[model samples]
Target: MAARDYGQYSGITRAMELVGERWALLIVRDLLVGPRRYGELGAGLPRIPSNILAARLKELQAAGIIRRAPRSRVIVYELTPYGRELEPVVLALGAWGFKALDEPREEQIITPDSMTMDLRTAFRPLVAAGLPATAYAARFGVAELLIRVEGGELDVSRGDGEADLAFAAGPDIRRLISGQLAPERAISTGVVEVLRGRGELLTRFASTFHIAA
Candidate 1:
């Protein structure tokens, strides 16, 4: 049984009952990045109450959205096939919410999994298809990412690597992706720092990864 019952019979209602809790969908979001151990999930969502995390895990498992599996002799939580189907829905939601995003609160923190999903949400495959293959090493706050675009495919992962462009930005990177800040303007205003590689590629990066805000 789910934690809430709306006394309605509908798909959206059922989904809300299953994953509408404060932290449930966030748990699913992180798991979408990859399998995570119990502690890893906790680390990713630093603000979640331990009891709430435990409860949500149990609820998600009961709803058939996730499962416990052994990897390297250690238990990890991963999305079930049914749960993986939520990827598109999550990405769409991220894009929708991005338009309203403002400055980060002092307590708000960026995690690698969250950044990875954000990139996935903003990736414009059609635009990238018209451009040459490019790689970008980016650091946002404490999270570092290596982003590669080849044709219509976008791949993002943690860590630094050789790339055509390297830059660091805080939350203001949103300004660039939203097209509110041109590459040159962003650089001059200190919204983004080009550490290596061609600075002009920041323009390409903006075009490749964008959300119309």
Candidate 2:
């Protein structure tokens, strides 16, 4: 498909000319988290047609927003530094769109990238202050993330392994982080779990992330 030239005078229009196509910004959103193989991208966006995804990747690469790089033995799609500058734009848009999130219907699905990004946006250093270093394994059925918080800092990485705490990622995670749900209640209900001596880590984890939405 030929790129749409929305005239060069209007910056927003020109910007849209680069990312206005359906699923274009979403592709950017996924790449913001980290590099992904074609299959990983497909798993994150189940509804996007494979052909359309291919086309968008080619378009983005041409736009200098993303690049193909060889990682290990596979080629992975990653955002350029210029592309990564879109982080605030995407996150601000997400924060603005939060109010529009209606109650979940039967058809709604939350992608792992979205979940991880939400965690990124919701992290609050003040809340994490004075907390001991801790590691958590967050499992969300199809995805697993390792989150480490220490010295009022948070780091999240792909893959799951041993950690101070292990918890299932669900609707309750948001609620817990938001203080809408009590930590004990979440644990009692099996919505969260922790190692034998690491129960306090769960509460600390919940406190460290605050999602106002």
Candidate 3:
């Protein structure tokens, strides 16, 4: 069968027009976290050329996925409420990619803030399973973390502890979650450290959440 041109159908053509080219997804990913200036976006994604970045930004704006915010007579790109809805898609795609990659030899260091966010998803199950009769939690990397529950409300805090499960990363949050950080060497010297829960209580809840492999 003769193959049709990708630039033909309106829907297919439009999808291609928006995200078909390289760097488009990266642009979307950058915006997923929060609003960022052009320079910040460019710096975060070094692989994209300036000219291409400008063009793609324009296309995203035209597609109503992003918009400019005014600040001291300057404009910065930010997601529109409609565009902000894509956060789930961006995160889900990243999660899927992480699982598809090879397992690393090193412990993926999950940071304090990122750990809080990760727990937002993973910790929910623990709460649903049954909140401990007392304050139940995990500690890692000289950091103490507690996600306490009572009366259907959630409380989270971090401090000092003989961390039963310590998590640290050799790379940034984006790299780890995206699975670009190599597994074999990443865990070799322990640049990124992960000290999992020790006792049986922590062990039972270990599968509660993960930063993939």
Give TM per candidate: 0.97, 0.85, 0.55
Lowest summed lDDT window (length 10), candidate 2: 192-201
Ranking by TM-score: 1, 2, 3
**How many Å off is the CA of 143 in candidate 2?**
1.8
Off by over 4 Å in 1: none
Kindly list the per-residue Cα lDDT of model 1 for residues 127-180, writing each as its tens digit: 999999999999999999999999899888889998999999988888999998
Model 1 sits at a Cα RMSD from the real structure of 0.9
Task: Rank the models by lDDT, top first.
Answer: 1, 2, 3
Measured by TM-score, the strongest candidate is 1
lDDT of 2 by residue, 37-61 (tens): 9999998999999999999999988
Better of 1 and 2 by TM-score: 1
RMSD of 3: 8.3
Native-to-model Cα distance after best TM-score fit, residue 180 in candidate 2, in Å: 2.1
Alpha carbon lDDT at 149, candidate 3: 48
TM-score of 2: 0.85
lDDT of candidate model 3 versus the reference? 0.56
